[model samples]
Target chain A: MIQDIVTVFIKEFKEILQMRGTKRSGWINILVVIGVMGVYMPLMSGREWVTNLLNPISFAWLPFFLVIGVVADSFAGERERHTLETLLASRLPDASILLGKIAAGVVYSLGIGITSLLIGGVVANLGSLEEGFVYYPLDFLGILWALSLLLALLMASLGTLVSLRASSVRQASQTLSLSMLVFWVGIFLVTRFLPEEARVLLSGFFTPERLPMFVAMVVLGLVVADAVLISVAMLRFKRSRLILD
Target chain B: MNDVIVTQSLTRDFKTVRAVDHLTFQVPYGTVFGFLGPNGAGKTTTIRLLLGLLEPTGGTAHVLGFNSQSEGHRIREQTGALLEHPGLYERLSALDNLDFYGRVYHLPAIQRRSRIQELLEHLGLWERRHEPLAGWSRGMKQKVAIARALLHRPKLIFLDEPTAGLDPVAAVELRNDLAQLAEAEKVTVFLTTHNLSEAERLCGLVAIIRAGKLVAFGSPETLRSRRKNERVEIYGQGLEQSLLPWLDTHFGVRQAGLVNGHLELEWPGDRELSSLVRALVERGVGVEEVRRNKASLEEVFLDLVVDGDKEPYTA
Candidate 1:
């Protein structure tokens, strides 16, 4: 099963790398994202970027969004291209295929996030040459990696479920995009319309002294959501149903 | 297993429509078994059922001695399929496409490489294998797909309408390549096609289906010989359309028509041809040449498909 997963992973990554018709274009897209988020943003943020506690927390969302762009194509793209039936006909176990797809999306998303962080570190040092080479605290780096991984897993799980039911890649993309839009709107509504007292209480709860607990709660919430979504997707992934789709 | 595949009253229904209805058949090992049907005749559905991609709504199917419903993966491990579509990743090169399936089947690297080479070279596509399949002609893509199916060298392979969209020359070329490869590999091929000539030329045994029902099953020769109507052609002018109704009403003459200035008649084989010619002469018909002909597989197929519900043809 491990070998099967790796095989599917390699195949999927190869396809993702050529999603733009050429490997060069695919690399360009990834590099562009890394440049904007990794280099430019860190350089503009100045020294506060490394010291600011909120920076890593906010950066975690990048992978969640990045995964959405490609994960929608996992199953839906194969169905649209008339390749799903043949794939289902192969000897590959269902779990391997599902995990491989999710792993591919997670790795791509987290890989970019990690690469950007490392690049951002360099950009931060280059900008702060007068202040001596500085870096993000080790604890913050660990938090960013963990948070990015969890978020990437959450979105990949959700995207795979959407892709499974979608008749085409366009439909899956629209559905995923709509969900993201809804999430953004929900956040905006909560942040902008919350009562003054509630906002105060929320800010107090997220203060540096209590930040670790807050992060732990978020991690716990994501772990539960990821488990539930992955389970549902697995349950829905029977070959008989998929072939009909 | 003596038979690579056996299905007993295998059935599938899509809501109100039955896609495969009570199909029962067995395919012996190492033979090209043709599943012939018109469009929407459930040929694809049956293949799906046999491959275990789609479960049967009723009855059962076993492939390679594994139950399709419970051991589909085991069956898939031992067989290959070229489904209704080529199913190649068009963005990838032909070599990449074959290589992907090789990995899916868990072929060792060295064996995978040699098998891909052997199939591509045999089909004359090795020279152009590095080019992406999206730019290739439909025929070329299909050849690559065939290579992918054969890469793992399974004991059985299912091919659905492989030459449906190809030009006549390409279709014939593909058909010839498929025949040679199937022979050389000694693989059991379950081929589905609407092309009667193709089926006749390649299949050792054939089954005909219509509206999800089995209409006929036998070799091309057996089906042709079993056709109830024996055809006779008489040439040399003066055979009028007016004589068709009389011939149709004759005791042994089933139907008659004037085609290309020749008199065409369908007679029961038990009837004597000499009496018919004498009667034609007496009727002022000039018979320059007379020929008795056996029905072609195409004619047999047409008869069974058109009047398929009459009775099932058994081997």
Candidate 2:
């Protein structure tokens, strides 16, 4: 059993790393992320990027949106290329399949996310202005890092679950693409519409309340949810239904 | 005795529809077991049940003497599968695909390379080893699927419609390889196919299924020799169904029918064909086609599946 699970783990990890267009797109996503963070340092970190340096000339911006747009395809893209079926049928048990898929998502999403943070870190240290650029605070970057893992984990698990139940890759892909809509909607409900108390409750899902509690809950939730989803999938997966069609 | 695969009234249902209805069959070691059935006859479902891909609604199945439910991973290691579309990773090269699955089965990294090479050569996929399966032709992809199934050198194979998409040439070649594998390696093949010709040509024992029930199970010759009609078709001109009527009256040409542009009859072997033809001709009926009524495997297959199959009410 241990061998089987490890085999599933390593194999799925390779798939996450080597999935179609993943390496190339992953490279581009990494670069774009670096570029966005390189450009966003002045504005977001209000330290040496003081009010005096504010000018259209300083606006080497407008490209950060592109990073999110490009990285959006990573999870849904596997479904499009017809690799999901093979993934589902592997000797790896159902939960392992789900875990590996999520792990791949994290690698792509977090690799890009952290690379962006690092590039932003470099820009903060080497900016033209005299003020410090890590002005968002160490705690802020940590929150972003922790939240990025949570977001990637949620998306990956959701993508795989949808992938299994869908009739085709296109259908599975829709779940991933439209999920951003849910993300934006949740953001709006919490920030713009929800009462202050309600926002605090929902903020717990996105950004952890305390550092330790936040890290523990998101990591714990992802692990526990992954286990539950896999068990459910094993009970639900019917090879005849998937293969015959 | 140690049975490779055994099922005791195994049943699986899709909602109210019984996909494998109280199925019972044993696949002994070292035999090419062909699963014969028409479209939607639950052949694939039965294979899934035995492989532990789907839980049985009732009854039980054992593979390699281990309970299917709890010991699925153990069964999977010893058993291989070749399903439709094969579900290969199109992004990976043919060699990588097989190697990946070999690793899944836990072949050591050192032994994995040789095993994959041996499988690729055996399946005639050596040239395309480096090519991604996505770019290969249908036949090529199928060969890779076969290679992956054999990568771990499994004890038993559950092959669902193994030759469904192959051209006649490839199909025949693969069928020959499967036969040799069965004969030489002493490996058991659990094959599911609707192609009667393929089954008749290759299988050690053929089991015909219909609507989740086992209608017929035995060696081809035994079923052919032991069915109700026992009919044979003799090809020739000057043969008339009316002329055969005399034979029906005199020599027991039970329920004579003309098919394949020839005279057919459920003939009894008591009277020799020479005398029967002479007697018919002497009676003023023409006897140009005077061949012995040897039943073809195809006729027997159709009889078991379509004609002689019991009524739904009875089923």
Candidate 3:
């Protein structure tokens, strides 16, 4: 089973790399994102990028959004291009296919996220020549890695579920983007309209002394959501239903 | 011969429609079995059910002695299919497409490489294997898809309309290649096709379905011979106006007419050619040539479908 999943993962990752019609174009797209997030942002921010405590948290959400770009194509794109049925007909188990797709999305997003972070650290150091070499603290680096991976898994799970039901890749992408928009807007509205006492209590919970607890809660929530979404996706991944869809 | 596939009262329903209704048949080993039907006649659905991709609503199917629903993975592991569409990845190269499936089937590196090469070279696509399939014509893409299906050397292969939309030359080419491959590999083939001529040429046994029901099932020779309307054509001068009325009046003749320069007669089962020829010569129609004709598979298929429309469902 592990070998089968790895085979699917290899094919999916290769497809992701060749998604832009050519390897050169695909690499260029990846480079553009890396250039902006890794080089430009860190260069302009300089030492602040490393010293700022919130930098890791902000960067963790980067993979959350980045995974959405490619995960929408995970199943919907195969169905749209008439390849899903053949894949389903193969000997590979359903679990392998599902996990391979999720793995592809997670790996692509997390790889980019980590690479950008590393490049940002280097750029921060290079740009801060007068201040000498600088890097993110070890504890913060660990938080960045964990949060980025959890967030990527969260998005990958959500995106794959949507892609499975969507009639086309365009529909899947639009639905995912709209869902994210609605979620963020709803959170913003709820927070803004919260009672003053509740707002203060929430703010108190995020104090530096309690920051680790807050991150832990967030990670727990993502983990729970990922598990539930993945479970539902697996339940719905019947060959009969997918073929009809 | 061993029965590679056996389905008893197998059925499939989609919402309000019964796509395949109580389909029961057996496909023997090492033989080409044609599932012949018109559009929307449940051919594809039957293939899907037999392949274990879709579960039957009614009875059961056993492929290679394994229950389709319970042992679907085992069935798929040993069987290959080219479904309703070519199902090739257009963005990938032809070689990549076959190689991907080879890996999925877990062919070792050396065997996979050689199998891909053998299939592609045989199908005349080896030279263009590295080029992306997106730029190829539909025929070329279909060839690559066929190669992909055969790369694993499955014991049983389901091909859904392998030549559905090809032009004459390309269709014949694909048909020839498919025949050679199936024969050389000694594989049991469950082929679904609307083309009666193709079925006649390739299949040893055929089952025709209409409105999700099996209307007829037998070898091509048996189906063709089942229709009792034997035709006879007599070609010569003075065969049109003078013979038309006389031929029409005869009791053995079901219908008679001038086709091109020949006198054509549809003979009932009890009729004899000698009696017809003696009557034709006596009528002063010079009989230069006379030949007996059996119903073509197309005629039998149309007859069966028409007959099926008039009768209640019984398979």
TM-score of each: 0.96, 0.79, 0.96
TM-score of 2: 0.79
- Give the per-residue lDDT of model 2 (tens digit) for A155-214: 555565666566655665565567757877897876787788876776665653475776
Q: Which ten residues in a row have the lowest lDDT in candidate 3 chain A?
A: A50-59
Each candidate: how many clashes? 0, 1, 0
- lDDT string for model 3 (B1-315, tens) is 489999899989988999999988888899899998889999988888887899888999999999998899999999998998899988788988888899999999999999999988999989998888899988888788888788899999989998988998999999999999999888999999988899999999989899898888889998777777787888886776666666666754547888888877788756667887787778777889888898888888887776665442223
Ranking 1 against 3 by lDDT, winner: 1
Shift in Å, residue A49, candidate 3: 1.5
Tens-digit lDDT track of model 1 for A169-198: 999999999999999999999899999999
Error in Å for residue A226 of model 1:
1.2
* C-alpha lDDT score of every prediction, in listed order: 0.89, 0.65, 0.87
Candidate 2 Cα deviation (angstroms), residue A150: 3.1
Using Cα atoms, each model's DockQ against the true complex is 0.83, 0.32, 0.79
Candidate 1 yields a Cα-based lDDT of 0.89
Which candidate's DockQ is highest? 1
Compare candidates 2 and 3 on TM-score and give the better one: 3
Give the candidates in order of TM-score, highest first. Answer: 1, 3, 2
Q: Please give the range of 10 consecutive residues that has the lowest summed lDDT in model 2 chain A.
A: A56-65
lDDT of each residue in B129-219, candidate 2, tens digit only: 8776667777777677777777777888878898898888888887877776656556788888878788888787878777888887788
Tens-digit per-residue lDDT, A1-245, candidate 3: 89888888888887888899987888898899889989999888878888885664578988899899889998999999999998888898999999999999999888888998888988877865887887888888997899899889999999999999999999999999999999999999998899999989888877889878888888799889889999999998999889989
